[model samples]
Target chain A: MIEEGAGQVDGTIRAVLRDVLGLTQDRVNAFDESTPLFGLLPELDSMAVAGVLTELEDRLGITIEDDEVDGEMLETFGKLAHFLRKKALL
Target chain B: MLRFGPQDGPVVIAAPALFEEANRTRAFLVRILRLLGVHGIAGALPDLPGQGESLLPTHQATLAGWRDAFATAARHVSAVATVSIRGGALVDGPAPVSALWRLSPITGAEQVKELWRIRQAAHDRPKLRYDPARFIAELDVEVAGNRLAPGLLAAMNIAEPSSDAPVRTVRLDTNPRPADLKLPGRPLWRASEPDVDEPLAQALADDIAAWVHACVA
Candidate 1:
């Protein structure tokens, strides 16, 4: 089971965003639980979400379902990290 | 004549994705592999049934058919492994190739989403009227640029291929690498300018070549 506060997940999420979504380093690093994703980030539009998810799954060896994602899951960096940790447990 | 390296050296079947991606990366990838002493085949698949000069329409194309085309390309060049970029990774390599190299593989669903975005971009122009939500529900409509048959879309909406071949992935900027090889630059391929960063390309080529050598050795 993955720990909740583990920093690596956050870093991974940030990296995926930068690499796949083309978010600037400053934009990615500034993200927190309140940063809001999905509808918030211009780069995180519906199309970019697929690439980001695919990158996470391939690199992290996690499986994500289309139905599993919603605004809450991607609400912020912390939320996204939390979601990944939960997925890792399952 | 396009092939590089000795007649029997290891060859990587270069399978690039559609449209702009193919235009940007195909030949460059092949050239890099050739420089690294492995023969790379860039023209690995025939045009989709309805795409290019083919008499069929895009709707006639299937993922399985494209796989067959990729297999034929593999057989044609006796490829030992496949080098797939972006959506190209969706094509399953035949059993002859023992390893698969995927670079930032994209999902079919994502491809559809991108197509939707492209359609949205043409809002200023008079284009066909179609809603992606309705199209996806029907599961046989064409969107973006390619024909998305149900089976093809199903096969494409995956991060990994169904092949038993061992897979190695190279994430451009995310994966940790030696400081010298780290991709510090943005993925310019996504921008409207769509320029290739030679340093990044060279770094990726080097990494791939090393992996191929290790696999074949």
Candidate 2:
């Protein structure tokens, strides 16, 4: 089971990206804190973002409001993990 | 092909979501169910208003209009049970539908996102353009090669199985992970190419038929 921590969250996020977007395991694992998402990753486009968010919601059991989404929250892999962890807390 | 089984027998309405899934699984599923001794009617639900040789244009379509069409489809064959697949599960349940069988059901948000993704892939866009939430807010986005009106998006957003309904889910796991250890069966949906997965369809047919039989019994 994935434990509650930054490490776990990052790994889970990576897994989701790999599974949902059909990204290679190596490619997803290569994503780190500095790696930009959204505008940066070609696979992490608008529609891909929706799929990612839906998977996140299902796996984490958290409700993400429409207004809450912006460039900042999804800027990087680390940022996405931190955002999800924060939601998990709430 | 809607009516099946003995004369005046129970009819199962096959309500599959529009677009690629409908293109892929509708006919295959219907045929499998018939062989399994289940009366199945595959609904040819139009994704857009003016679609499927209809006279009305898509721009004029509303959420209620789509619901009316589904209700009409269900009425044509007098559906006693509902077998909703993929995004079709998001449609409002037809009246008198006692049992709801969903196969790999997806949310309205997923549908919207998928439409955009398919569009993006089609165009080979360099980056993501449409934000799903904001796109929906615009209330007039193109989806699955058709127009997505405001009302229709609202309906899709709210389309979910009710508490009172007896809903069962058959998740086809294509990429199994440790988290999906509980659900049996390999992911046959994506195992092969060309959209039609006969083995997966057969498994779903058997599962749905058994469930329908038990429900009626």
Candidate 3:
């Protein structure tokens, strides 16, 4: 059950990035913990960051306070998922 | 006003999503209207005051004004149903249409939150915050480039999509909210630039056409 829940969180994060940034499924599927986001992905601009966060909130049924957002949370796909896992899985 | 499809029969008056979402999804909405025309359903998209080509300045627009304007437009078109996308749902509450169809409808509070988030993101300042109640009372408070009136912002904080008529809610499959139906599609409203999703448009048109038929039958 824990494994399934973790997978769901990971999948939700991937989908939010793909949908908000207009990334192809193949591109997002390739994302691992180390896959860099934020500064690296051209599509993940500042505006896109807001879209990503809001979409994540809507999909996961969680509230993300503005204070909780920071560069570290979005530096990599893994970190972002980790942040969401804490909020959603907890 | 943009009209499509047949000259007579059950007409649908569409309310495009508010603010930037409206610009991003205008083409997509137009495509849906055109497809609805092909389905033999007439569609009308009116320019709400202070939006589109209306002469009123953006800062002067109030939520009540938008609702009143939409109702008037629906009356003018003799619309049988009202179709709204996103924040557009907030504007159609008072229309006299027989049925209401909404795509990913959001409450006014959610809409305001999005605007503030966009503003914060644009400035790259995550800590920047405002007390919505107090902030809206200020003059010339612009969020994401649209100068908004205090009354509009205040009303939005408390407004929600109307449930007076039979309502059909459609959402993207990505959204977990309960909906009458959910369709697979990227959110055009979040696109960095204006874009079109023809397949999604086709799916929505089919859904709207079928729903309208069921409602009128």
lDDT of each: 0.62, 0.61, 0.88
Write candidate 1's Cα lDDT for B1-217 as tens digits: 1455565567777666654455446555555555556323222333434444457667777767777877776787777778777677777565378778777666666665555445444332333343445545666545545655665555554434545787777665554432223354444334332445567667776777777777888
The alpha-carbon deviation from the true structure for residue B199 of candidate 3, after best TM-score superposition, in angstroms, is 2.5
Evaluate residue A9 in candidate 1 and report its C-alpha lDDT on the 0 to 100 scale.
73
DockQ of candidates 1 onward, in order? Answer: 0.08, 0.08, 0.63
lDDT of 2 by residue, A23-71 (tens): 7789998887889988988767665665577667756667676457778
- When summed lDDT is taken over every stretch of 10 residues in candidate 3 chain A, the lowest stretch is A15-24
Worst 10 residues of 1 chain B by lDDT: B38-47
- Which prediction has the highest TM-score against the true structure? 3
Q: Candidate 2: where are CA atoms >4 Å away?
A: A1-8, A25-30, A66-68, B1-11, B18-56, B90-92, B95-98, B104-165, B169-203
Model 1 bad stretches (over 4 Å) = A1-4, B1-12, B17-56, B71-82, B86-145, B150-200, B207-217
TM-score for candidate 2, residues paired by index: 0.61
Model 2 per-residue lDDT tens digits across residues B1-217: 3445455556677665555546445456555556555434223233323444457776666656655776677676666667776776765465466777777677776676666655554555555454766656765566546665666665656566443467877673432223211233322222112244456666666777777777877
Indicate whether candidate 1 or candidate 3 has the larger TM-score: 3
* Maximum-DockQ candidate: 3
Mark the 10 consecutive residues where model 1 chain A has the least summed lDDT. Answer: A1-10
